[model samples]
Target: MENNSIWVGKLKKLEPSDYTMSILPKLRIHEENVMEFLRLSASKPEHITEILKMENNSILIGKVNNLIFSDYAVGILPRLGIHGENEMEELGLLAEHFEYISEILRMENNSIRVGKMRSLVLGEHAVEIFPKLKICEEGGIEEFFMVTDNPENITEIFRTENKNISVWIRKAKKLRLENCAMQIFHNLKFQKENVIAEICLSADCPYHITEMFKMENKSIQIGKVKRLELNCYAI
Candidate 1:
């Protein structure tokens, strides 16, 4: 157990459980009292100590834990200068409050950019926040790999029959599926700069660019050729 004296300057400076024990009780003292104490707890640790002295520490900690990860707590975290509880939970909240988030709210944005598969499906505004390729990679409508926000920009040409991915990207350039990107090579702007060299030099991408590398023409290359695999082979 840590000395509560360490929490004299800022409640956020302490671990979440400790801070929750110290501050939730004070804020929860009044049923109407909500996030007002968050600002104070973040800025004045002595004030927190005073309140802690009056709380039933064990009871407060228990109660707070029961609600700390609830949706209500998600809104309060940003106010208290906290971002999230952990990687997965935070992503879900951030995906919900996409418009209000900034780069400073979190340390890493890579995983968040692609978003969890579940979030990409659920994020109502996810198309606006994530890159087309990233959104597709995370799980997106097959054909909309780029932007077209206005009504005038909506063209009858791209609207395919049934979310069924029928060579939409191939007709457009590459191929996309009903649910995700088959790959991004046909985006033109992001085509592989050295795919042939990378594939010839590395075996990891054996079928990734099979047509361009002509992996089927074993006479042109030399190696222990293994069985080919479909993208959805396991499924």
Candidate 2:
């Protein structure tokens, strides 16, 4: 038989501390695999949380209804933490559900005409989707709003210098008065004194306009008439 005893003796000659240190990398690899297995086998929320605490290094967090993970998993895991493929898949599904719920909420009408039952459903859907909506300034307009749904088509409407402002006002709900020099007479005919005109100095429009109804010298807030995204579902 080969002298296996000689190799054993050589290993024994190393200090106990040295031997322990040498195996640490391998032990960590094994521990990572074990944690991954546990994550896959986890069926209940409690089990997932327990496993997550053990592998607290993982960027992914699994909850009863949601799973959160980093956007870049493959590049991030070995450096920051580790996660199993199955865990990533579960996280993807959760993200899809979040997106779906958000789209439903955005498509639902929030107008004054919606009945109580429909309004309740829309409110619930809005709550569910609020977290996922992407918010940005609408063409430098400071008024912040959520864009839950993307429009399928976009059309531009422009009026000439001679066109009646009143006609455009009646047709427009949102207005983008960017690069034009025109005074809009509000609640008056050919009267520039009570004009609500916006001026643009830059190549890009400096101001955005939304249509409002005036009653008793007060502006009533109707739906905004800026660049709007219309849904196919909207009637």
Candidate 3:
């Protein structure tokens, strides 16, 4: 019988074990079908990894595999609680799926931490609807400091009093920052130096504020200590 006909017949069998051992072999005879099966079985992490190692580069094979793997990783892996000590292993398998799916989906947003597979599906539609969704920064202290006090702007919020700025800065290094300016200042003295002067002296200045100074050079003193203090209070 033809491979297609064989696959059709196997699909009719309705048994996963039978499908795994019997139909899978025949379906894999063609690179395209093999890719398809690999994708459909993406929740089966071991199988998907094996398929990724295949040499075939056919567009259909790649596309279907990607779709299947993405769906399985993002959609299926989070729900499994298998028998025996394999439960955590199963979740680990799903985590690997999320990692691979994120890469295949060309997602650059490190903000969506994939400790589990469920988050994959959570963001899948957003990515499809807006490919730019992946460009968004993961939330952090800098983000919090940017748009706080606006009820509509808050999504996730964390606050710590007297937290060291350096510690937060270190944590931010592990996250993605999309088009945000970052700077650290040392030895800033409010008694003598103006806020504007301190900012001007700093190597890295916020872009928008710097632009305002450029457009109105005389209005903004380059190194006036008193003016800088007032501006700091306003912020």
Candidate 4:
């Protein structure tokens, strides 16, 4: 909504408050909202350019299909909550055309692809979209947390990087990791005896499974026992 008055012109000048009901909904726009329209219209370059210009040439992010991996997108990625230039470099390696990203990662509508993503921040309802995320590699999602049942979903608590990874899946019934390769963990312990063990034993890249179930059975269970499953390789 940068310089919103320019877009609305006379309408915004005439009826400032009513413009929201008259125009914003048709454009599906709200200030401080994640520019999802960029994702939807990424395929059309002209439309993308037009939208970007309309938004005062804001950053490009979120499944920007078919567009070039230009400096514009790279510069704005950080604003979209994407961490690290290394992660953007990995994204650049995916394909020349950004559209190939969706095909390569098997992305679905509203699904998040965490492949090569170093940091992951999720809310309480995150587990609903867990199946949608394409997680690959050992340290793909190194930082993650699901705080209290409230909306104050913060990621700064107990976050360790590079040397060791700490994840707090509070009240998360099922936690699963797949296709982890070349992992090195100094302290890996399974917190509970009842925790399921389904890890690959790679002598070259040794790692351990640590599952902590702190919540009561009734609180965490989704009609089943709380479990942590990792289908890892070379870990």
Candidate 5:
């Protein structure tokens, strides 16, 4: 698409006028699998939308694996000259999947309201833009993500009781902080004993756990050395 010659060549071959036969069927369903290739192959081929809208009830359908609207459709909307916050609102009415729009925004390293970031099975990087994001108000921390790069978010989730207490327990163990993990375990409203034992086994520090045993053995050995010194001094 960067090359003007290739752009001219494709248009000359399809001749814009012949797009009905040459292009329209490719967008028939949500795969956009076809259009993904087509759009990147050509630059600013906005007329593709015209071909799509020409069909009966131009409203888009949700994809097979998707919870709501088609991700592929939301992605191409921007290329069709639909962009920005207000544009999102316009498309929001038609969209079955709001998460896909959030994903598109994430791809661009952009942010949106936490309400729009719902059904967030993906887009981990996008949600990192808060306290700008009101995730707790929308649902809770667990509603958005699981593993995060930020430790602050981990503490925030625990503080809000946004998930099962065991989640925070596991996270604290993962961070390898024994004292904090112990405190979190004590605070849990309900506890899973098996899971707690598993975390302790995984988190055990051999040196710290055996410190008193090691010191007692060293003192007994030190008494034998003191007896030897006394015997030499008497000789």
Candidate 6:
């Protein structure tokens, strides 16, 4: 009998004890019935893990992995609970967080650009990856943190969705902030040739502001800035 011909009404009769390879994969299971589906497929833990690798199924994967590691043929499924655990460890394959994560948040080396990743902490190596990463209207890097010296890198990171981004510059060779809106520069050792934007230099802005304006008569275009706050000692 072909499994596909079987009605969805008959799914209740299917049991883990039956142990039929063909039936499990063909059945269209729902999230509510995932426990039964996992049990029916427990003979092959690899299959379950592979599905997990492809889908971001949530805390249920972690619980199932624990059961599999304990040598249970098919662990009993209690009422669905939010364990708040994302990481899973069966044969020690899951990572805390990897560079690339699609919907499933697993380690993938194919593409450096993150697909549906939400919270990712990019280190010094991020500058190289950001340029190649595509900025789309859909899922993108929500929160980004990096310490880089190059102003171009800073610009690149902000080019994408600029929601929650923090950048620390050791020093900028060329500081250009024209037409920048609502940007706060804090405790920066800046050396530039021009400042033509309508900006507000407040607090610790140098008393020797004239030195910063020693331009070479070259119009270094910094676009338009609505307001710029220089946070330093009293001016």
Q: TM-score winner among the candidates? A: 4
The digit string of per-residue lDDT tens for model 4 on 1-235 reads 4323333211111111211322322332233332211212122333233323332223223232121122222212222322112232122211123332323123342243333543343323231223334445444443332212321111222224311222222112233322111111122322433232222222222222222122234332222334333333322
lDDT for predicted candidate 4 compared with the true structure = 0.27
What tens-digit string does per-residue lDDT give for candidate 3 at 128-220?
211212211233222111211112111111123212322333222121111111111221112323222122122122441333344433443
Cα lDDT of model 5 by residue, 81-104, tens digit: 111111111112122233433434
lDDT of 5: 0.26
Model 5, position 145: C-alpha lDDT score: 21
TM-score attained by model 2:
0.17
Per-model TM values vs. the true structure: 0.20, 0.17, 0.22, 0.26, 0.22, 0.23
Q: Say which prediction, candidate 1 or candidate 3, comes out ahead on TM-score.
A: 3
- Listed per candidate, the RMSD to the true structure in angstroms reads 17.2, 21.6, 17.4, 15.8, 19.5, 16.6
**Which tens-of-lDDT digit does each residue in 41-121 have in candidate 6?**
233444343233332222232122221111111211111121233211211111112221122222222222223323333
Error of model 6, residue 20, in angstroms: 33
Better candidate by TM-score, 2 or 5? 5
- Clashing residue pairs in candidate 1 (N, C-alpha, C atoms within 3 angstroms): 169-174, 170-174
Q: Candidate 1 regions off by >4 Å?
A: 1-127, 131-185, 194-230, 233-235
What lDDT does each candidate get? 0.25, 0.22, 0.25, 0.27, 0.26, 0.28
lDDT, residue 6, model 1: 33
Looking at candidate 1, what is the lDDT of residue 13? 17
lDDT of 1: 0.25
lDDT of 2 by residue, 1-235 (tens): 2211122211111111212322212222222231211111112233222222332233321111112221111111111133322122111111112332332233322211111110010111122332222212122122111121211100111223223323323332222221111113233132222222221111122221122112234342323232343222210
Q: Candidate 1's residue-wise lDDT over 1-235, tens digit each?
A: 3333232322221233324635443332221221212211123233244343442222212101111221122223222312122111112221223323223234222222222222111122222223221222322222223221221221222333211222222222211211112222222222323121111111123343333343234233312222322333111
Which is the leading candidate under lDDT? 6
